[model samples]
Target: MSILYLVKKNDELISHCKCEESLVGDPGQLDCPWCGCGWLFSCTKCRKAFTFAEAKEIDKTWEELAREDLLGYSGKEPELEDINSWIDCMQNMVSHIEAGKTYIYLDGCFIPADEENFEFEGWKSKHNFYKTPQVIALKDKDIIDEVLSNPQYWEENIIQEQ
Candidate 1:
C-alpha cells in the first residue's frame, strides 16, 4: 500500500520520480527508499528544489479529491454582518437627512452618530489587531477638499452611499 506522487503539467502529461528505479522498502519514509534520496521534491529535469508554496501535493489514493486554498477572510464574522446592516441603514437615511446635517465615517462605514462617543461595540472591539476606528465627519470641508483632489479615493469603495 504505497502512495505514488505525481505532477501533472497538462491534460495529457504526468510526471513521476526520475530516480528510474522502483521505490524500495516500506511505504512511509521521508527519503526515497531506492535512491536513498531525501529530496523527493527536487525537479527531475531542471534539478531545482521547490518551496512548499510552489509545489502541489496529490494523494494518489484519492484521485478524485479536490484541493482548496484557505486564505483571507471567510466573512464568518457575525459582527461584520451587523455592521454591514447598520451601514445599509445609514445609506438609506442619507436621502432623508437634513441638507446641513453631518455624518460620521468610521472604518469604511458611514453612520449618523456622535463621533466622540462612537465605538464599534462587538467582540472585535477588544482585539488589539482591530484598531479603534478613526472618526471623521463626512461633511468636513477638509475631507471634501482632499477627496476631490485625490484620484485614489475615487477607485476605492470609500463611500458606499446609495
Candidate 2:
C-alpha cells in the first residue's frame, strides 16, 4: 500500500527534478521524490532526506529500498498488480495515523496492518509498515515542527524510568 509516502526537506517537499509534486505516485513517478536535484529522500514530517553528499551512492539503491519498504517487493525485480488493494490497505492504515508524525504506508501481498499490531507471530515476514507518529499534534504545535526540531521526538517524548 505504498501510497507514495511523502518526504520533505527544510519544511518543504523535495520537488521532483521534473514532476515537482510533493508526492510522486508509483510506476509513473519516474523523477526525483519531488525535486530532481539529487538522490536524497526527505521524510515529509522531518523535511530531511539522505544528505546530498550521499546522493550518488543512494541512487543505486534508493528506489529498490523504497520498493521493498513500500510494497514489500524485492530490490531486483518486482511484480505489478492492481493498486486498489494498496489503496484499501492504505485507507485502513491511515485510520490509525496519529498526529505529530508521518506514516510510511508499507504494504505488500497482504495489508501490513492486518496482522496484530502489524506483526505476524513474532516475526515480520514481509515489511509494509508506515513510520507514523503517536501524536500528529501537540499543544497547538504542528507535529512536523516537532519532528523538525527533533527527529527522535518519539524517543525523546518517551519517559525513561529507573
Candidate 3:
C-alpha cells in the first residue's frame, strides 16, 4: 500500500510523497504494518520515497554497505537490547550522531566487552555516503553533547560506568 510522507516544516505541514506508490506507516514513523495511514520515508538525496516496510528492506540491503561502528564502550561491544534499552531510557536513539552518518542506517556490531583498547576508537563506522539525507547524514551535532549534559540516563544504562 502507498503511504504519505510528511515533514514538520517549522511547525507547518509538508508532504514529501503521496501515499500511492510507496509504502507508509503510522504516526511515529516507526515501521508498523497494517497501520491505519501508511507513512513513507523520503530519500534525503534523490528525493525518492518509500513506505516504512520498504525503507526497512532497503536498509537491510544496504546494511552490508554500511560501515561498522563501535557504538561505544558498552562495557566492551554493543548489544542490541542494551542499545535499544538506552534509546528507550533516553527517548532518543541518535545520542552521539556523527555528521553524514545514520545511526539507524548502520548496523551496530556489539562488542560485549567492557572497554576499548588502544586498537579501538570511541566509535567506528563508514566514511560517508555519496547520496543520502543531509540532515540525517549530519550528526545531531548536539546528540553527544546532550547525552553528556544528561548524566543520569547515560551512566545508569548506556555506558557501563566504571
lDDT of 2 by residue, 1-162 (tens): 232233221222323223232231232212221231122333322232321111011222334433443443223434434344444443443344333333332111112212233432111112212322112222333534554234253234333443
Winner by TM-score? 2
Candidate 1 local lDDT, 1-162, one digit each (tens): 323222322211112434332111111112111121221223323332221111123333221111010011122333544445533443342333333333322222333333344444221111111221212212343532343223343334233334
How much is the lDDT of residue 14 in candidate 2? 25
| Overall lDDT per candidate, in order of appearance | 0.26, 0.29, 0.25
* Rank list by TM-score: 2, 1, 3
Estimate the TM-score of every prediction: 0.17, 0.23, 0.17
lDDT of 3 by residue, 56-119 (tens): 2222211111111112112245456554553343223223322222112211211111212212
Q: Any idea how many clashes model 2 has?
A: 25
lDDT, candidate 1, equals: 0.26
- For model 1 the TM-score comes to 0.17
